[model samples]
Target chain A: MAWEARSSPTGCINLLHGDARNSTSITVFDAKGIHTYQPGWLYVPFGEQDPHKLQRSERRLLQRDIALLSGDAGNVVRIDPAAKQLQTADGQTHAYDYLVLATGSRNAPEEVSGFAEGADHFYSEKASLALEKKLANFTGGRIVTGVASVPYRCPPAPLEFTFMLEASLRDRGLRGSTEIHYVFPINRPFPIQSVSDFVAPLLEERGVQVHTFFNTETIDPEHKIVSSLEGEDLPYDLLVLAPPHKGQQVIIDSGLGDRDGWIPTDHNTLRVKGYEDANLFAVGDATDLPVSKSGSAAHYEGHVVAETIAAEVQHRPIRELYHGRVACFLETGHGQATFLWFDYEHPPKPPKPRRLWHLEKAALNTFYWQLIPPGRV
Target chain B: MAATYQIDKTVDAKGQTCPMPVVMLAKAIKDLKPGQVLAVYATDPGAKKDIPAWANKTGNTLLETVEEPGLLTFYIKKA
Candidate 1:
């Protein structure tokens, strides 16, 4: 958003990317595995004929957008927020008037014991795809889905996966044979009380055992068991872990981020807290925004950051403040989805599962493909 | 038989997905004068429904539609 918004209106803008070729849709990644279980193509249903092709096309579109910036393709190896200077991998230094750090988050599977080596995580594109093979090979046994920590991107994903898995298992005539367990670090099924109230019964009705406050301490992958910090053990044939998440390493190296590598920012303004004079800002999963690190949150952050940058460029006061708007679709299995919309101020008011919401959720991929790379949204 | 209007621009939105066809069409149509026809060739299945919807919403008149193998074409007159 910063790249396109600042280019023609303000001045020549230079943009850099580590790799512009990869386009990740976490929601799609979650849904993609479902296709392997059943007779449906999530990508095709979502208007992405081929994900790799879509990625390449999106990269090309982004390259076209960045061409306006006149910036070279190089990975930013170092950032000095105070100095407003960045060093790229190609041995070049670029100075910026305003810096926007949107490095996003990465899976910290190592944070969980035995997770890095033993368990399969469905947070990343590659890992999520690998799960398809695991699911395909499974005959029937205990299937464990749980989170290693909170503040993971997309809070509702694990529960949604649970529903999809159950639906898939039922389709395969294995639902009765298999025992499904959903473990959460928090006491509740979801962060939002109302949504949890709405979904808890659905989970119970579907025979998914809910295990809360199960702080994942260690995974005995050898024994096929997950042990909690309190010494509670849950045995499983297959374990799907929602591993810990951390911000980009560059944020830590720049001395602009917290211990977890997430940049501390004014939640409303999105301005990096300490170095306000530097005009440094951050968005997405990289910021300590205290909101779901979902695409919708990032979209809201983008608007505020862009407005803040525009205001600074034009010598106007930055008035636009982010209200932490974010939305997610909970798949209730069998071609049904419910909309979960909330913000920092508002409690989650999720609509009931319906075909309309499912269609809207499917169409969002096309919206993402069209708007995000081009910096229009 | 109806008389064919002069075509001003044709946007090749093939291989591009849903909102992109409309997005590109919106951008292309903005450069056209009132009553000038803009044709868009799209391969995305969503465009068959989306283009007409977009045209209706934005007050543009969808003039013609042509369906061929692997592609759908739509002509819109700027309103």
Candidate 2:
């Protein structure tokens, strides 16, 4: 079996390496050589973790038997699924027996007017480092943190960042003098009802102002005001917005994705929906799955897809199926954390925040590369 | 009144968190014969609801739920 996997360093390829290394020949295409632990970005702005520690070389993470195509030769330009071929930027064409797309979503701060110039975000390494420096400055006035659109990766990230920011300010003796506001598009603090029930009171008790139903429209950088579609304006001396996200542009160029560049994916099989019989599959944030665009979802989906593909290669029955399972940890600052775990039929009921959970989250971060990329745990 | 049944297997997921308990249950139940019973002990609060939900979705029978100090035991019969 010959497999063609395209994306930045993704969990799917890693899982494929582990599952089908003997029966299948796997080739991964990724122009970018660096892979970052994205969840660690939230801790960067708070000075809790170093941004440099979050990244690793993509080549080093893969097994030696797995082929990696990097640089311009690895940059996929067009994918002709009908022809079962992929054309890279280097003018090379490669055919595949099967294809798996893991081209994850990217932050589109430019989608919101003035957002690129006005807001400091923690979605990328450069942006996170810049925000860390900006946050380290002495004074604070009005700080606002929220999102610009939905379907963003890690739904709890903005909220967790807000909580950690408040704690950081308190530690710096700026809590009393500074005003912190949280703006959200929905009516609740979080999309999940149980999690929101636990978080809302904590926000209130901490005196963090909440502005619900405030969808960010534009930012007036000159006056430091962010206007919402709901005919409201929030003024802030420092603004941090979780930029809107969209699927990769290459997906759009290939005409293989929806308007937002997300591929139509089968929720259960993790296969590309329209071309189900074509041996095409999608995973991670690139898929139009009604689940959080978090690494945990990708990891779970990766396992299912890897198993299905490996079984097909071995002429065995495909027994594995995805149940929309996702698990994520929410950091609530002050060394306390909680987690959410649920699937298609079940909704998440977050447990009470505990210091032990926080320690567990930290431990996971420490062993992420060893556990996830190797498919060891 | 304490109700008892012959437990074919007991999975002690004690001190384990979400996903682990459910994942362990899913893996353990696959080896059981039809009508065989599997018991799981967990400490995560979310497991109290998750275990039952998992049983319902997997078409298994949740025979009983017993709660003690910092512990939860779920009895599930394979479908």
Q: Best-fitting candidate, measured by lDDT?
A: 2
Judge the docking of candidate 1 as incorrect, acceptable, medium or high.
incorrect
Question: What is each candidate's DockQ, to 2 decimals?
Answer: 0.01, 0.01
Off by over 4 Å in 2: A1-12, B1-79
> Cα lDDT for residue B14, model 1?
78
Indicate the TM-score of model 1: 0.70
- Per-residue lDDT tens digits for candidate 1, residues A53-120, read 33422223443334222223235567787777777655767676767776677789888779876677
CA shift of A338, model 1, Å: 0.9
lDDT of 2 by residue, A1-377 (tens): 23333334355666766666677788888877677798998888878888899888888888777788878887888888898899888999999989888888998988889998899999998999899999999497999988776768888999889888888899989999999999876555666667789899999988899986566778999999998754579999999988988888889998988777988898899889778888998888898886778888888888888889988887889989999999998988888989889987787888888998889999999999888777675
Model 1 per-residue lDDT at A179? 99
Mark the 10 consecutive residues where model 1 chain B has the least summed lDDT.
Answer: B15-24
State how far residue A125 of model 2 sits from its true place (Å): 0.3
Weakest 10 consecutive residues of candidate 1 chain A by summed lDDT = A24-33
